[model samples]
Target: MDPRARPFRSVLYIPGSKERALEKAKTLPVDAIIFDLEDAVAVEEKPAARSLLTETLKAGGYGPRFKIVRVNGLDTEWGRKDVQAMAFAGADAVLLPKVEKTAQLDELSEMLPGMPLWAMMETPRGILNADALAAHPRLEGFVMGTNDLAKELGCRFRPDRLAMMSSLTHCLLAARAHGVVAVDGVYNAFKDEEGLMAECEQGRDLGFDGKTLIHPAQVPTANAAFAPSEEEIDLARRQIAAFEEAEKNGQGVAVVDGRIVENLHIVTARETLAKAAAIAQLEAST
Candidate 1:
C-alpha cells in the first residue's frame, strides 16, 4: 500500500522493556505500534530489553497493526544489535531517533539492506535538514518528536502548539514532498481526552497522516480524528456521482449543494471515499 493511503490513524509507542505493555498492545485497535528500545529503555537495560523484545516479536501475533521497532542511534552500542534482531523478528520497519542527516540513513541502509526505515524528527538540526533526511531511499515514514523539540528550543508548551508550528510544518512538508508518511507527536497528558482530540484534529487539518500515541487510551480518538467522517464519505459519494454525470453530459463541472464541483473537487472526493473504505477494511481485519 502507498504510505499516504495506509491507515496510520494511531501509531502507539510501547516501551520494549515493559513486557506487560507489549502484551497489552496486542489487544489494542491501534494502526501501528512502535516497540521502543531507545529512550524508553534505560542504559543498563538496553541489551536485555533488546533480547526480550526480539523474542516477543518472534513469537508474533500482532495481527494487522504495522510493527515498528525503534532503535537507538548508531553511535549507541545497542543500536546495531537492535537492527540485526529486528530484521528477522517480523517488524515492518526500524525507527531511528533524532535522525538529522541522510548519511545516518545511508549507513543503516547499507547495514540492513532491504529494511524500511522510519525517522524521528526531534532535534533542530533534524527539522532543518528534514528534506535531506526524508530524501533517503530507504526512508518510508517520519514521526515528529515534539517533546524533544520543545526541550531543544527551550519553549514553553501551549495547548495551541503555536511555538512549534513552523518546525512541525517543515518536517511534514519534507515528508510529503519525499512521498513518505508523516505522523504527529504525542499529546503528553494521556488522561486529557479533550486535549488529545484537539491535537489530533489539528494535526489532521495540518496534513499529517496520523499521530504517534503514547498510550492506548489515545488510540481511538486519534483514529476517529484522522479517518474520514460519515458526512465526508456521503458528500464524496455525491460529488463523484455528480461529476461523473456531468462528464457524460459534456460539461466541465457539476453542481452539488448549489456549489461548483469540478474535476479537482472530484479528485478529493474520491480520495475521501477511498480513505474511508481503507479504514473500514483495516477495522474489519482487526
Candidate 2:
C-alpha cells in the first residue's frame, strides 16, 4: 500500500518498558503504535526499556499496523545506545524527539542509515523549522508533542486548543508541503470520551492524518473521527456520478445538491472514497 494512502487514524503510544503493554498492542485495533523509549520511561528503566523493546520488535507479532519507535534525544545519556539497538529491530520508522532542524535528522540517519525518520514537533525552534525538517530525505512523518509545546510556550490548556492553532497548522502545512504524514498530539484526558471525540474531529478538520492516543479506549474514537463519514461517502458517490454525467453532456461543471461540483471536487471525492476503501481493507486485516 502507498504510505500516504494508509490510514493513520489512531496512533497509540505504549511505554517500551512494559511487557504487558507491548504484548497488548498486537491485539489492539490501532492503525499505528509508537513504542516509546523516551518520556514514558524512567531514568532507571531506560536501559532495560531499550533492550526489551529491541527484542520485542524483533519478535514481530505486529501485523499490518505501522510500527514507530520513539527514541530519546541524542543529547540524553541513553539515546545513542537506544538507536544502535533499534537500528535493525524491525520497526517501520524511528521517531526522534524535539527535532529542531535537518541536522538532527542527518545525525539520526547516519546512525540508522536507511531508516525512515519521524520528527516530534514539540519545541519552538522545531515548529519554526518544520519546513526544513519535513523536507529531510529520511523524514516520513511528524508527531505533534502538544504537552511539551504547551509547557515550552507557557500556554494554558483550553478545550478548543485556541493557543495551539498556529503551531498545529504550521506543522501541518509543512507536512502537507512535503507529503509527510502529520499526527496530532495526544488529548491527555483519556477518560473524557466526548473531549477526545471533539479533539479528534478538530484534528481531522485541520488536515492531520491522525491523532496520537494515550490509551486503548481512545482508538475507536480516533478511527471513527478520521474515517470518511457515511454522509461524506454518499456525497462523494453522488458527486462522481453527477460529474461523469456532466462530462458526457460536454459540461465543465456538475451540480450536486444545489452546489457546483467541478474537477477539483471530483478529485477530493475520489480521495474520500479511496480512503474509505483503504480503511475497510485495514480493518479486515486486523
Candidate 3:
C-alpha cells in the first residue's frame, strides 16, 4: 500500500522489555506498533530489551502492522546505541523522544541515513518548533506525547484536553501543511473504554489521522473512529453522483444534505471513498 494511503488508526505502544507483548502483537488488529525503548524500559533492562527487539525484528513475524522503534534522545547514555541497533533492526521508522529542533532531526538523519524518523511532540519548545520539524524530508509523522506535555505544562488533564488544545492545533496544522501524518496523544486511563472511544472520536473530528493506544483494548475503537463511517461513505457516493450528473448539464454544483456541493466538495467526496478503500485494502492484506 502507498505509505500516504496507509491507515494509522491504532498506533499501539508496547514495552520493548516484554517478550510476551511483542509476540502477542503479531495477532493484534493494530495498524502500527511503537516498540518503546525509552520510557517503557528500565535502566538495567535497556541492553537486553534492545538486543531482544533487534533479534525479533530481524526474525520478522509482525505481519502488515507498521513497526516503529522509539529511542532515547542523543544526550542520554543509551541513545546512540539504541539508534545504532535500530539502524538495521528492520523496523519501519525510528521515533525520537522530546524532539525540540529541526537541527536535531538533521543530526539524526545524518546518523541513520535513509531511515524515516518520527518525532515526539512532548516539550514546549518542540511544540513551538513543530513547523520546522514537520518540514523535514525524512519525518514520517508526529506522535503527540500528551503525558509529557501535560507534565511539562503542569496542567490538569481533562477529557476535553482544554489545556493542550492550542499546542495540539499547532502540531496538527504543521503536520497537515507538510502532508506528514499526525497522530493524537495516548489516553492514560487504559481501563476507561468509554473515555478512550470519546477521545478517539474527538481526535478524528479534530483532523488527526489517528490516536495512540496504550493497550490492546483500544485498537478496535481507534480503527473504527478514524475510518470513514458508512453514512459518510454513502453521502460521498451520492455527492459524486449528483455532482457528475449536474456537470453533464454544464452545472458546477449539486445539492446534498440540504447544502450546496461544489466541485471542491467532489474532491473531498472522492478522497473519503479513497480513504475507505485504502482501509479496506489494509484489512484485506492483514
Candidate 4:
C-alpha cells in the first residue's frame, strides 16, 4: 500500500502478547495498530507473541485500520524471526526498533522484499544518522523514540518538551525531505487527558504526521489534533475555487481571502480535502 495515502493521525501500539488488547484494537478508531513484539513484550513471551500476531493477522477482521508488526531490532535473536513471521503473515509494514544506521535497513530490505519498513529513530546514533536513514530507498518512515532519547541525553521533562524540540524537528525535516511520514512517540501518562492533548497539539505544530498512542483513550485526542480544522477546510475550499477560476481566466495566481493563491496553494488545498474525505469515510464505515 502507498503509505502516503493513509491518514495516520494516531498509530496505536498494542502489545502482541495481550490477547484482550489485540482483540479490542480491531474496533478502535485509530488509523493504525502496531503489534509490538519488542519492548512491550517480555523476552520469554517473544515466541508466543510472534505466534499470536501471525494467527491474528490470518484471522483478519481489522476493518480499515492499517496493521503493522513492530519487530525487535536486528541486533537481537528474536528480530530475525519477527521479520520472517510478519512478512509471511501479510502485515502492511514491519516496524524496526532502535535502528542506528541505513545498513541495518538494507539488511532487512533484502529479507522482506516488498514490505515497507518503518525505522525507530530513538537513540543518539539514530538521530545523528536521521538524514541517511530517511534517504534509504526501503525506509518508508520514522517513529521518534522519545523515552530512550530523553534517557540517553539526561534530559528532564519540563512538561513542554523544550529540551527535545531540536531533535524532534531534525527528524521532521529529514522525513519531509524524503517525503516520508514521521510519527511522534507515545505519551506515557495515559490517564492524563489534558497532558495528552497538549502533547498531541505540540506534535502537530512541530510538523509530525501523527502521534504514537499507548492507550485507546488517547486515540480521539490524537485524531483531533492531526485533523484539519473546519476553518482550515473552508479556507482550502475557497483557495481551490479561486485557483480554478484564475486558471479559467488565464491567470497564474489568484487572490483568496486577501491572500495570494498559486498552484502550490491548490495542491495543499487538494490534500486537505482528500484527508477530510478519508476521515469522513472512515467514520461513516465505523
Candidate 5:
C-alpha cells in the first residue's frame, strides 16, 4: 500500500450470511466492505457465509471498492477453512479477528503468501503485543475493536471513551511506527448522527486514517470527517505554492499567510492535496 494514499475512511461491515446486504453493500459508496464470517454469522451459518463470500468475490463488479473477509480466529473450527477460501478468493485483504501474536501472523503469512493481513487489536494479549504484531512483514493494517476491548477490560462504554483512549492511541502509534494504516472502531449508536460525527472527528484528531462503520447511514459522516475540507485544501495549495516559489528564489523557507512555511510543511501540504484529490476522484467515480 502507498504510505501517502488515504485509506478507506468508512469500512462498512456486511454480514456474510445476508445475501441481500452483501449485494446492496457492493453498490454503496463505502471505501471497503468487510464480509464478516465471525461474529455476524451464527454457528450453523458459517459454512454458508464462507461460500457466499467466496462466490461474491469471484463474481466481481465492486469497482474501486476494497474487499476484505473477516475470518474466524485460528482457534475456532472454521478458522482454517476461512483462511483457505479467502486465500483463493483474491480478496484485497484478510481480516483476522483476535490476533494476539506475531506467530499467528507467521502462520497466516505461510498460508497466504502475498495477501495482506489485517489484525483486529481487540484482545488484551493483542494489545500487549501490538508493537510486535505490527512489525510483521505481511501485516498491512489494524482495526481497533473497542467493543470487545471494553468488554475484555471490564470498562464501561462511556460517551467519551476516556478509559480506552490511551490504549487506542498506543495502537495508532504502533501502526504509524510500522507504516501501517490504523482505523478506529465502529460507533455503535447508528441513530445518533451528531454523536457519530463527534466521534469521527475525535478519531481523526487521534491520527486514525479512517473508521469502521456498522451502517450505511454513517458513511457520509465518516467521509466528511476524514476528508480534507475546502479550506484545508486551499491552505495546503497555498503552502505548496509558497514553498515552491521560495525554492525558485534560492530561499530555504517562505512565509505563507503571515506564517513561515518550511520543507516539512510543504510535504504535509502535498500529502493533504493528494488525499483531497483521491477523495474527489473516488466521489466522481461513484
Candidate 6:
C-alpha cells in the first residue's frame, strides 16, 4: 500500500521490553504500532529489549498494521546497536528520537540502508528545522513527541495546546509539503475517553493523519476521530458527481451544497473517498 493511502488513524506505542504488551498488540485495532526501544525501556533493559523486539518482529504476527521501531538516539550507547538489530528485523521503518537535522537521518540511513526512517519532532531545534528534516528522501514520517516538546519548551499543558500551536503547525506544514505522514503526539490520560476524543479531534482538525496513543483504550477514539465520517463521504461523492457533470458540460466549476466545486475541491473529495476505502479495507483485513 502507498504510505499515504494507508490508515494511520491510531498509532499505539508498545514497550519493546514487555513481551505481554507485544503479544497483546497483535489483537488491537490500531493502524500502526511503535515497538518502542527508546524511552519505554530501562537502561539495563535496552539490549534485551532490542533482541526481543527483533525476534518478535521476525516472528511476524503484525499483519498489515505498519510496524515502526523507535530507536534511541544515535548519541546514546544503545542507539547504534538498536539500529543494527532493527535494520533487517522486518520493520517497516525505524524512528529516531530527538531528531534535529538531516545529518542525523543521513547517519541512520547509512547504518540501516534501504529502510524507511521517521523523526521525533520534539525539540526546539527540530521544530525550527522541520522543513530540512522532512526533505530527507529516506524520512517517511514525523511522530510528535509532545511530552518531550513541552518539557523542552517549559510550557504548561493546555487543552487547547495554545503554546504548542506554532511548533505543531510548523512541523505539520513541513510534513504535508514533503508528503510525509504526520502523527500527533500522544494524549497521556488513558482513562479519560472524553479527553482523548477531544485531543484526537483537535489533532485531526490540525491536519494530522493520526494521533499516537499511549493505551489500547485510546485506539477507538483516535480511529474514529481521524477516519472520514459518513457526512464527509457523502459530500465527497456528491462533489465528485457534480464536478464530473460540470466537466461534461464544459463548465469550469460546479455547485454543490451552495458551495463552489472546482478541480481543487474534486482533488480533495477524491482523496477523502480513497482514504475511507483504505480504512474499510484495512479494518476488514485485520
- Residue 247 alpha-carbon offset, candidate 4, angstroms: 3.3
| Candidate 3: C-alpha lDDT | 0.92
Computed on alpha carbons, the lDDT of every model, listed in order, comes to 0.92, 0.95, 0.92, 0.90, 0.89, 0.94
RMSD to native for every prediction? 1.0, 0.9, 1.1, 1.5, 1.2, 0.9
TM-score of 4: 0.95
Stretches of model 5 off by over 4 angstroms after superposition? 3-6
Error of 2 at 230 (Å): 1.2
Write the residue-wise lDDT of candidate 6 on 142-246 in tens digits: 999999999999999999999999999999999999999999999998999998899899999999999999999899899999999999999999999999999
Per-residue CA lDDT of model 5 for 17-59, tens digit only, reads 9999988987799888888999999999999999998998889
Residues 33-102, candidate 1: write the lDDT tens digits: 9999998899999999999999999999889889989998899888889888887888999999989899
| Clash counts for the predictions, in order | 0, 0, 0, 0, 0, 0
**Ten residues in sequence with the least summed lDDT for candidate 4:** 1-10
TM-score, every prediction: 0.98, 0.98, 0.98, 0.95, 0.97, 0.98
| Model 2 lDDT per residue over 241-277, tens place | 9999999999999999999999999999999999999
Query: What is the clash tally of candidate 5?
Result: 0
Q: Higher lDDT: candidate 2 or 5?
A: 2
Higher-scoring candidate on TM-score, 2 or 3: 2
Clashes of 4: 0
Q: lDDT value for candidate 1?
A: 0.92
Q: Model 2 — TM-score against the truth?
A: 0.98
Could you tell me which residue pairs clash in candidate 2?
A: none
